[model samples]
Target: MLSDYFPSVGGQRAPDAELGATLRDFVAQQQGPISAHLRHRHTQTNEIGRCVALWPVLAHIAQESGGAALALLDVGSSAGLNLGVDAYTLCYHCGGASVHVGGAPRTDCRCCVASCVGSAARSMGCANLPVAGALSHRLGLDPMPVDVRDTDATRWLQACVWPCDLVRQQRLALALELARQHGWQVKQTGPSCIEAIHAWLDGLPSAVQPVVLNSWVLCYFSEQERARHEQAMIDLVRQRGVVWVSAETPSLRPTDMALPATPPHDSKGATLWCQVSHHAGEVRQRALAWSHPHGAWLQWLG
Candidate 1:
């Protein structure tokens, strides 16, 4: 149905009037199917483009650990495409300079692009950014996990993407294919991200540093839930020595968390990238960067 309506997915391009009429007619004819879909499906976009923003942060983590193996746990990971972050090629443009990471020759990986914005763009050096190494283990936790191998689920993921955004559609296709080839594990867990963390953290190998990550997921939780999630993350950091990385709206972030010295020029429509960790007895949170919700651009604060 999506492919039939959107030209980007091989649908015929129609005039505005024709398109509206056709959509209305289709909806009228497919009322039952549409109703069933609406009742069961949730907006679960697995935006692989966000991996561009994640790459540098993971690299920084690896560098901090002296290149030790790291395990990744992604909360609300729909189809777990971003788990294969190291499998894609990330191209970043900053201050008229560019840097590429991941995807060796003959890999046939899709390229995800991003740019550095604002004052940070001028000072940021592509040379100093650490390269993200291979992840030791990648696990995803979601209340309702989408399986990339499932035809219906995969189609729904495609539908979640904006019809006009052909670039994102292509990226998602390539990412889905990569996910199928890799067969990353995504466990169906409870609704609370905190519960998922507690359930999975103890099972990871002690030798590998655990990095719990979530992108644009905390907003789904209530203010109280968010606070509990934050406290849980801090507890994990203090007791289990894990790192928490988040890419969410600033307003959604815990009030107790530290703010960046220089905030983004425009916070509206921007996602805040943060890293929370505990060393000794104190817990610290640092706002790493501010980025587009879909990784179009990033303003570094680290």
Candidate 2:
């Protein structure tokens, strides 16, 4: 269904065609580190430039909620390693053989083309800003989380990574270690994960704004499941919560960005870091992105 909707990695169902023969072999083997390395290697995220692009909008969520202490959730958060985004002071290591991290978020301005959804998100009045402070509170949720601590799980995580990019693998390792150092753990378990999240939400003192984001989750869901989960989200929204979700377009119908709309395919270059606040069925979208990561450009599609 995802392939029918939009182009997946290389748009090929088979392994060799998408990432090459090595990946196909690795996936079939299903070894531990190899899977993780493959996943980290090919599945993006190591592109710190892209992730940092929307720091500010995320920061805005913090400001709106209260401070650096708002609950953050990442749906389909593979290894759940990136959930510890706050621990590492990200630095873009692009155009280099090794990851060139920085002690802090880069301070530079860059340009990016807005996606159709991004344009609409801007129309909704979202503003992007660099926010190290807000990132401190981010968290994650994934169905088959890669157990970074378990040797086998780590191996599986690496194996799923694209076979070619060792840099990505190393970057993931570093990020996982950093997250672990911070006492942030991602669990591998049941449907109650959502329930646990709701419980966490319920536990919050309400002084902070609770935000839920599930980027690229629709691809994994069947039509029925998508309907059910989306309804759940709607119920959450009705309860006055904030949700940040973006799925590749061609995979979904193009509609108002304010409503539950699929993002456009080929909408590259820019990201929509929007905040939605609905008023009597009328919602406003906030478009924001960091624009740059210490000189290197980034695409933050929050």
Candidate 3:
């Protein structure tokens, strides 16, 4: 991790040091083992921050569907952190700006830490609805799912965090705790995972609505694979009406993918949000809002 070599701007071993040079020197030392490290380390950052923007859309869907229990299938869910989305509380500040804070940043620190915040709330229709008992079945699908109980795996997940961000780190700790308490399972996903999902959905009672979610996962797939997966979901919707939510980077999601015009951006960078429903061979897409990939904050356009 480049962050390990990064010295904080101030109050560090190398005060007034050039950041670029320090990073270069560290990279030089890590030259030969970079590939080996990459093979072992999955950049599977389960950005719990993303839930700030995701939860509202989820709640809205559940509420609109007559408050029916939901079966949430999270693809590329490393360690299943977001599977516990209903466990946490959200605090909205100044309309679009929402934050989720829990526990102390450090054992010695007394102040509460706000981990994730959306950039802006362009629309006010988003309500902080109750999440309790909203989810009946939670399935985490990943090619490689980390075992939260394994100390090594858990440590690696924490190491993936930006070295300087203690607030985010603390939030990760809390999310892990919640995941364990909730007993969320991380399962292997393959080409057959979709078929397995269909089987699972078929067995569920008519009352339970199915919701499929994935954040920054399709980028791992080739363009052809992504297209196939997208088509499969579209087909599935026609068979049984389902909800799909995705958060992707600009390269993967074109501005015109859902909406015709370009969306607005915040300080973090460009992220594209899409919510869709396909039924009776007709596909309807809602351009929810542009959000930070890590859910730092979001501008709610839905």
Pick the lDDT winner. Answer: 1
lDDT of 2 by residue, 1-302 (tens): 22321232223344334455555565567678666766654332322323444344456556555464666666666656545544444343334222211213322322332211111122211133334344434556666665557676665565455544445555656665655556565544464346756765776665556666654445566777666665565556666565444322233311244432223332342234445544467544543332331213443333
Higher-lDDT candidate of 1 and 3: 1
Stretches of model 2 off by over 4 angstroms after superposition: 1-50, 65-68, 92-128, 132-138, 189-193, 245-275, 279-282, 285-302
Best by TM-score: 1
What does candidate 1's lDDT look like per residue over 25-69, in tens digits? 889999999999999998879887677678778887787777878
Question: What lDDT does the true structure give each of the candidates?
Answer: 0.74, 0.46, 0.66
Better of 1 and 2 by lDDT: 1
TM-score of 2: 0.60
C-alpha TM-score for every candidate: 0.85, 0.60, 0.77
Query: Over the stretch 1-302, how does candidate 3's per-residue lDDT look in tens digits?
Result: 34544332223343235667867777789877776778778776888777766776676677657788888888888998888776655544433423221211111211111233232222232233334337888888887888888887887788788767667777787788667766798787675357767876887788888888878888888888787777777666667777887777755553236442443334345456677776457777766655566665555555
What's the C-alpha lDDT at position 257 in model 3? 60
TM-score ranking from best to worst? 1, 3, 2
Error of 2 at 149 (Å): 0.5
For candidate 3, which ten residues in a row score worst on lDDT?
103-112
For all predictions, the C-alpha RMSD in Å is 7.0, 11.0, 7.9
Pairs with steric clashes in candidate 1:
none
